[model samples]
Target: MSSKLRIWVTGASEGIGLGLLQHYQNLGWQTVGSSRRTQGPTVADYWIPADLSDSADQISAVNQLMTEVGWPDLVVLNAGVGHWATADESARSDAERVFALNYWAPVEITRLLAQRAEGRGLHVIVISSIAARFGQQKLATYSASKAAVALWAESVNEEWQGSAHRIQLILPGVVSTNIMRHSIGRDGQALGDRAGAHRGWSVERTVRAIERATRSGRFAHILASPGVRLALIMHDLCPSIFYLLLRRKP
Candidate 1:
């Protein structure tokens, strides 16, 4: 058996975060899970509740985890929401709410963990989206927020060049999750039918990739699907072409 590692997974009540929590716990690692609500699985060692949109609550939750678990060997910032709104119909409040949880909250949590885990072999995993690679008509805000997160992870990885601590960005394509089912457009219209087919691997496959990447500790960024990987490369090589292809109506 592999040596158990102390791990913390945010947004652990459901989706990728919950899957990771279960996987690690089954691996004999001590896992701490956090979510805004109390619907998380019962396997985690600690379930800290806090609203990620509130800075104070986020900080308090982290502090509470630190007090009880010291510093986690791995911290996965996997809690996020998806919003699709036309530029004009998207309310300012809606955009801000999305940024709060998807971008700002993760940045704050990672910053605090980086400081607390200094000198330790800490690995921070950020679950960004393939949307960051190219622009989608109605998902402008969501794409931008994820792009910010991916960029932030790259910057932090650069900063930790000579240190033991590392940051990994997991950019996943559309997966089977409640986020897709519950997505709404700027006009408060349901985008469920427009979500398109699931393109790549299952959530389990992505979780396995994360586990392998975490163990290998070689790649700083992980593209969850072949399509997303290709899109990312294309975006880097020929952004115009990538955008043109991604701009098709869903």
Candidate 2:
């Protein structure tokens, strides 16, 4: 068996996933990455190409990892898609597609890993958006899916109280990524430039925060700007006022 520390990162083709994969690689650890696209630039010692949104693919990827690479010291369930649409503009199919990748994929993957761990200690980190903390205007479906997974992680952490396995959640507000350009829109198509530009934390900074959180033994870590943090505090402590402010036309 390989003695080097190992980490598995999903959606390693880009965004925070790619950043984490590279960071660990720089540390001389064994890195395994996966993406839906079989052909793409990636940084990983091993690359498993599987569309995790599909149930069968999810199993196949996990089996491949366990059979070939043994087990990783850390598993980052970061494969996710974004959706942008108003309630009226959202279609059922699009919503399902969003949830398939953003919610069910990670939940199912974590379940399989936990079962296969067989008393082995496993550290699972779930990357959920800060948007999951509360609802948003155009992010109805996306926010709901994220919230579902975040809550699921929270529940799992509690459920695994006495076990060697643990679940950590990363709630990042906004990181510079192509997620916006690739986000699904009302017509179930990439929003492209219509989604508008977003300026937030860089992928490197967000990854550093995640690294800190994983080491901090925290159940959930919120990576957001002070402005965003204040908003979340308001949402939690003063929902009435928070929603009242949200009602204002922007």
Candidate 3:
């Protein structure tokens, strides 16, 4: 039998990253997990410990990852934080931190990984959000950051088409994650939300779509369920109506 494919996932500590890690691990992939901590959160074949919030740590982590694996067949850029700050309550630093993890970290690490590939085949999967498509309610910074990464993936797919890399931009609707609660919930808590999180999709559901898309050699996957996809479509087709519908209740 052929050797199992190798993968490296960032933000392997929890949520979507954790889901992907566990799935791939169970499938017998030669997987490596990276997070701020060296221990706990998961048991992978290998681990890459690096806090992506710091540039030095990021560079070190990438260097260490390349040293250990040379280049993984696939790199899942899934590490990010959830910020809960109102427009008046939020600070510039908070937004910057979100952007650092969500946008810049992924870009730099992916850049290093792509270059390391040296024209070999590579799959780059990014876990973005359906929130990327809409500027709804109070998640301005979070929404913007997700949108930024999605846009970056578009440009990357354009620039690297004939090269070693193919990018997967996944825009998943609200999943039952703490990060989702933090991003969509009020007072930074879901509060048993009627704001649609109870009906939010599962991490497994989202990751399965990712797997399917990857197998098909596709570049984009929007894993929004029927209603969610409709709402997003409506948001695009009728921005004014969506603006009113998506806003929180008074």
Candidate 4:
């Protein structure tokens, strides 16, 4: 048996997931990565191509990981889809797809891994969004899905009290990723060039925060700008004032 630390990261082809994959690889840990695309950036020791949103593909990917690399010491459920339509403009199918990948995928993966852990220790990191904190405009489905996963992790953390298994939730704000361009639009198409521009923490910084949180055994980590943190505080401490501020935003 190998004593090397093993890690599995979904959505590892690009963005934050890719950053995490490289981070673990540089640490000399055994790295396993999965993504919807068959061809990867050749960063991981093992790459399993699967669309995590689909139930069968999710199960198959997990089974393959367990069979090939065995249960990983750490699993990062970072695979998710984003939506960018107003609540009224959102399509039912697109909403379901968002939840399928962003919410249920991580939840199901957690369940499967726990069942396989069989009392062995396991740490799962769920990559939620800072948007999960409140109902923001034009991101109803995306926010809802993230909020669902965030709450689910919280509940599961309580259930695993005093147990060997642990779940960590990571709520990261906008990173320099193609997520906006890739977000689903009102017509169930990629927002593409129409998506609004955003700039925030780099993937390296976000990954560093995640690593710091993991080392400190924090239950939840929020990687966002100071302004975003202040907004969240205001939302929690003064709801009426928070909404008033939001309304005033142009």
Q: Rate the local accuracy (lDDT) of all candidates.
A: 0.80, 0.90, 0.78, 0.90
Clashing pairs in 2: none
Ranking 2 against 3 by TM-score, winner? 2
- Give the per-residue lDDT of model 2 (tens digit) for 46-98: 88899999999999999999999989899999989999899999999999999
**Model 1 over residues 1-250: C-alpha lDDT tens digits?**
2246788898898888888988898889888898888655887787889898899988898899888666788889998888877787788888888889889988999887777775777788888987887777778888989999889888888988988877888877766767765566666655777765544566687788788877775645555556667778898999888777877635
Cα lDDT tens digits for candidate 3, 136-227: 55678888899999999999999987776688888877677777443433344432433434356788987777778778777888887687
Measured over all alpha carbons after superposition, the RMSD of each candidate to the real structure, in angstroms, is: 3.0, 1.4, 3.5, 1.1
Instruction: Using TM-score, give the best candidate's number.
Output: 4
lDDT for each residue of candidate 4 in 194-214, tens digit (9 for 90 to 100): 988868889999988898888
- Model 2 residue runs over 4 Å out of place are 40-42, 246-250
**Weakest 10 consecutive residues of candidate 2 by summed lDDT:** 36-45
Task: lDDT for model 4, please.
Answer: 0.90
Backbone clashes in model 3, listed as residue pairs = none
Identify the superior model by lDDT, candidate 1 or candidate 3.
Answer: 1
Report the candidate with higher TM-score, 3 versus 4.
4
